[model samples]
Target: MKLNTNKAVLKPGMTLIELTIVILVLITLISVLFIGAKAYKEGADNATCILNQEQVQKAVRSHQNMNAKNDTESFPHDEVFGATGIISEPTEPTEPDNLYAGMQDDVYPVVGTAYISCTTTNGNGPHAPASTEGW
Candidate 1:
């Protein structure tokens, strides 16, 4: 019965080919994960930018209603941001972190009840929704 005990021995470490294959597989998986994460982050940023635009629009309407302003009248950046208690500090759509880019930092004028649009011209990042002219 003990005759076949030493017939085969298990190796402690993987061979070079096995190691290479494993490394390759790991690299592929990691790259896929990174790509998926990037897409997900971009989608999230776009959604957030859209939501911010909607909120700003609502604030503008509220301000206009409260003050009896008309759609033809445009308001300053600070009207909705500081004067009203809606958004204390608006987020600027900057580069790298912001997929919806090209927002001015100091100014976010409420104009004619239209949605706030991102002026990014790169054609790579998120764009404003065509239906409402904003993200």
Candidate 2:
């Protein structure tokens, strides 16, 4: 009978510390991915908000031209909003507690040559051209 002892042969699986490290790494990667996704979503939301503002601006311009209203004149919010109007309801900003979203009713079209500026001032910030901005 021959007994063979080999110290070179080791367990194939990772050690406890190695496993913990891998888990931590995976967690880190997952967190990073989540952060990136969140940022991307915010950016996309911002863009959509901007486009909505532009659409509303164009609609307001159309309304003004059709009704012969001047920029200094304040138009009714319902004039260009709704399905029957030039454009449907403009989408609000996705960010929480957005000033623009809250002040949709108070917004009017006379700001800075009817540029439609939002007063959010938050991180997602200033979703200008709010639905009421050009109304």
Clashes of each: 0, 2
> Model 2 lDDT vs. the true structure?
0.63
Error of 2 at 115 (Å): 6.3
How much does candidate 2 score in TM-score? 0.68
**Which residue pairs show collisions in model 2?**
116-129, 118-128
lDDT string, candidate 2, 18-117, tens digits: 9999999999999999999988876777777777667666777777789887655666766677767677765466644543442254234554444344
Reference-based TM-score of each model: 0.66, 0.68
How many Å off is the CA of 60 in candidate 2? 0.5
* Tens digit of per-residue lDDT, candidate 1, span 1-135: 456656587779989999999999999999999988877766666666566666766666676678787665655657667655656544634444442232233233445434455543333564455455441
The candidate maximizing lDDT is 2
Computed on alpha carbons, the lDDT of every model, listed in order, comes to 0.58, 0.63
Misplaced by over 4 Å in model 1 are 1-12, 93-113, 120-125, 133-135
